[model samples]
Target: MLSDTSGGTSGFQWHVSGEGPTDNGVGSPQPEEEESASGVSDRRAKVTVIVLCYINLLNYMDRFTVAGVLPDIEQFFSISDGKSGLLQTVFICSYMFLAPLFGYLGDRCNRKSIMCVGIFFWSLVTLASSFIGKEHFWALLLTRGLVGVGEASYSTIAPTIIADLFVKETRTNMLSIFYFAIPVGSGMGYIVGSKVNDVAGDWHWALRVRLQHQTSHSECFFSELNVSLYFPLHFCCSPSFILSTFGFTTVAFVTGSLALWAPAFLFRAGVFTGEKQPCLKVPCDNSDSVIFGIITVVTGILGVASGVQASKKLRTRTSRADPLVCAAGLLLAAPFLYLSIMFAQASTVATYVFIFLGETFLSMNWAVVADMLLYVVIPTRRSTAEAFQIVLSHLLGDAISPYLIGVVSDSIKKSDSYMWEFRSLQMSLLLCSFVAVVGGAFFLATALFIEQDRHLAENYVPSGE
Candidate 1:
């Protein structure tokens, strides 16, 4: 056999003729070219993952900062508990409604450009929200909803991009790193919102500062470096759907309530007291925010990192690992959630400890569940799947949890008893514990179908490149 060894200076090419076989191997050596291509692919994938993680960070930060400053917002607007909770509900409603549209566009359009526009749109709306006067509460609500529309575009599509860049195991680790931002960002939102409100003397200024920071960061980090690079990278659920959706909904309900109201709940529980004017000598004791922030960041980082490692290890042995991990986390979280609420009226320190443990367990599911979704869905339908989950989860979960808690609080306060004010919040929050158990059960059910769905997805391949 005659073999052509060289085609171009760029790389060696192998050609075979029936004449003979080479002494060394069947194909010509092209180690340098192969290595170069592999290196570039790896570098691009890493850069893309980092950029997406940062954007995810900003998304959660903007979403939860309002919660951090909820008390100030409540006071400024003279709003009831129901109204306060309604703010989050409005945001989620807008987000859920627009998610499917973006998801459809994401699969068909240039995802990077869509994400860029979304980020820019939300940042602009956030900036506009800062200027909303106390009298213009309706305007604030409108801007918040618009911000949701922007976020929906990015959140539904980003994970699909990551899935295409890597195989299953690597994707799990990347997603864990990406989602680690959730708790960290939520915690920072609280700390930043509280500190900014203290320094600036108003919630409006606090929001403005954070929004401006996020805008600058996104433009500088993502728009300039990542948007252009994102175009080149192209690659890469049933009873699992129902159960996972139910689990996610319950988790979202619990998470939304905590993210939006935990700081205020603690304050009302006597862990901290509010100053009439925080800027009046910076008198507001920020110990609550600082402590909660520390717990969230530390535990969240560790929990997610460890969960990824565990899930990856378990997957080597069993295909059901991802959902099982989620189920375990939810199950562990339920007891701690109950403990946290039980201790709320008894001891602040115990309440904080239990809350810390509960958050740690709860955080474990974030990345694992996302990884499960990526593997179960086909490459072309991932965005749609994500959008559907967002709608279902929010519609049944966080969209109403905060408002329901608020309504419960307000109704209890209508009673003649003075203690009902605090007791009502405690009772409302306890619902999260029960919901956590339900979430755990759903995840457990998901485990039964996850292996089959994942195998089917892995075997099926799309025709086009």
Candidate 2:
């Protein structure tokens, strides 16, 4: 029942019937308030955004919590930098591959049900990961990888739902709010995980504490297991979507590296400067994770907020405002990132200030990029578009960055000396600056075709029900 397009739709499949959006003109409508106007009431839309944001927050928080306790886990498992990097790589790989199926279902299924099932799976895996023995490090990796199924389901579906609920400025604002979870949840993961570790004197507690919301589990894991027997592979010809995703991939690369390594790098910097001791034992200093997490939260808020405001204002002057703003953000971030890396060995204050500036600019793309994707594609394809973006970005971006940095660091380090460790990681991270510049260039190129793609999407109509 799935077939290819004969015209300009590129990778879009012919519309499928019998399973259109349940939230829209299908079956019994929702309540008067829930389906009030334009099939989505203002109150209901706001509530939906709030709920999605909460789920998003929990998702990111669960993900980065491991980073918060990386030192403890490393000590407990006795792993090398490359093996340490595998933790993130495995999770991302699973997430990336599972996204397409989730994307395909999101377009034709009940989005809420899909997300609930996904989250529940994630929670169960997380609960199990906490009980794993130190000797069973592979088990921990397996659970982390499985957790991706739930995340991929939610992530691929949520933004498209937001796109359906609102239009123009309202959608941009809501998307911005939803993306705040990226930084906030991420920061909380680090802050909460490390604090829990300190209190329980075991890294396992970090995973256990997230289960405080286990009541939400039954709603999470269903989407991951849904049978999509023949998922049609699709593509987008929109240059704006393609280029913006390339730019966003760089953001993922930089952020993923920083998320796992920034805290460790800072701790190592302290040791190199004679300000702190090397983590010779378990539960070593997580203060760096805490501090870096704080920076990530604060800068992320400022970055997303300012980028949205700037794009909103710039829209008055240019049709390509979103991509232009995205370009400016990454281009400006490159130098600050370089400064942050170079300053780490010298002044901690200088390193932090530069990191703040760098991350703030880097964060500017989160909501703007999503908004760009929503506008450049029609509603039905948004989920699939989101999935493609995620796969490409993570496959080329964060999925490899953490491991690549670790492998590069391991290759260059001549010994187990603290200085070599610090030097090796620092040098590997410097690659982020160049990557940022390349991302900016992609966004700059996106600006050229943004208007054309948006025009096509604006006039698009589904060939069937």
Candidate 3:
């Protein structure tokens, strides 16, 4: 059931049965590694970091690509505000529920292979969106749901793999770099969507097309699943089951709603329309929409880069545990969010400032949380933790945001007024800000419990089996 806490110990014992070494014994190796003869751990950690970083990038790109082309999606399908919200809801819902299963598998299998399979499948889904016709609503929904399944596999496993590769103290830094892809990938997706739309006259086509893959799905998904499952069934016992479920459920609730309504609200607000005055004054045509999409893509990319850099520096000094830093980032982002919304009416410097700032703050949370998990959980337990995180964050964060906004917008005016739409989207920011504050508080509490070694013992098993 347990192992000793000496630094040189290998395998699962590094996490579970260790003593003398505090915080899951992650720090014990530092003093020994410096004096020892091998550089294997360091090299392994580097490779893991690089791989997961790429995974994070692809994950976000797949998610946001749809958002980038949302305006066209709404127009093509004649999707109502509520139904549009469902587009995001369906994907997130499937993701949130399935994450725990993937997390379980990651803990039991070859996480690397699982992640590769996920990326390959979701990329295909992204390519698939390119071919969907306007009336293929069911097909689109099904495809998006499948995309969720692919992401679920990757999201749960990657963090576990990273945790297995890195020690606690350095974990946050690596996680920050890896999670930085949320914004960068999202930015790239926007850029790609906008560029494709500019040339093809339809953004949906950009999202649905697929690229070539060298491997097969079963080989990827099952191999990882088997490795994790065959390792030990005991890891799935007790609190993990409950926690994983709760986490995934929370994420589905929040993110599902956010997907459907965020863009629709913006479109209604005339933000998507890129018009200055009130509604009906200028009927929105597909003619000029791509221009705003391009601006958004460029701004999002720059902001993501800036945020990633700032986060990297901040983590060096703050150990990525500073809730103050997280809080400050969100506070900084709020005004930009407001300004950007207002700026949708005008492409002024002020608008760009708001847009960029909003993205910067919005970008930090994932990396921060990812770092927290990589440091807190044992290597063998990381996949479960990550799966839990995905479930909770989305169920409570973005899953319901879009839908809530849509319902509220519909309630406020019950009319197709641009002013009402703008107001509705602006109001949703309040919720986003609130969630950020709550997340920051949780991070602060978690930090207090973190030992100098960078792992928390309240809920962890040593890495040794």
Alpha-carbon lDDT, every model:
0.75, 0.84, 0.54
| Candidate structures ordered by lDDT, highest first | 2, 1, 3
TM-score of each: 0.85, 0.89, 0.72
- Count steric clashes of candidate 3: 54
Question: How many steric clashes between backbone atoms does each model show?
Answer: 2, 12, 54
lDDT of 3 at 146: 85
lDDT tens digits by residue: candidate 3, 100-215: 89887666554556666777777777667667887788888888888898889777776555554445456555666665565566556555655676577766655643243212
Model 1: lDDT of residue 100: 90
Q: Write the per-residue lDDT of candidate 1 for residues 1-465, one digit (tens) a residue.
A: 222232212122334444334547677543332111112246666777888888788888788878877777877777777889988999999999999998877766566677778888989998899888778889988998999988898888888777766665777778888899888987887788778888887777767766655566454232111111121112223667667878988889999888777776776677322222231222344456666777888778977987788887887898788788888888999999899877877788899999999999899888888887776776557777788889999999998898988988787775634356567887888888889899999999998988777777667754543
Candidate 3's C-alpha runs over 4 A off are 1-48, 124-129, 168-170, 208-210, 213-320, 342-348, 428-430, 444-448, 451-465
Candidate 1 ranges with C-alpha deviation above 4 Å:
1-40, 217-237, 271-286, 415-418, 461-465
Top candidate, metric TM-score: 2
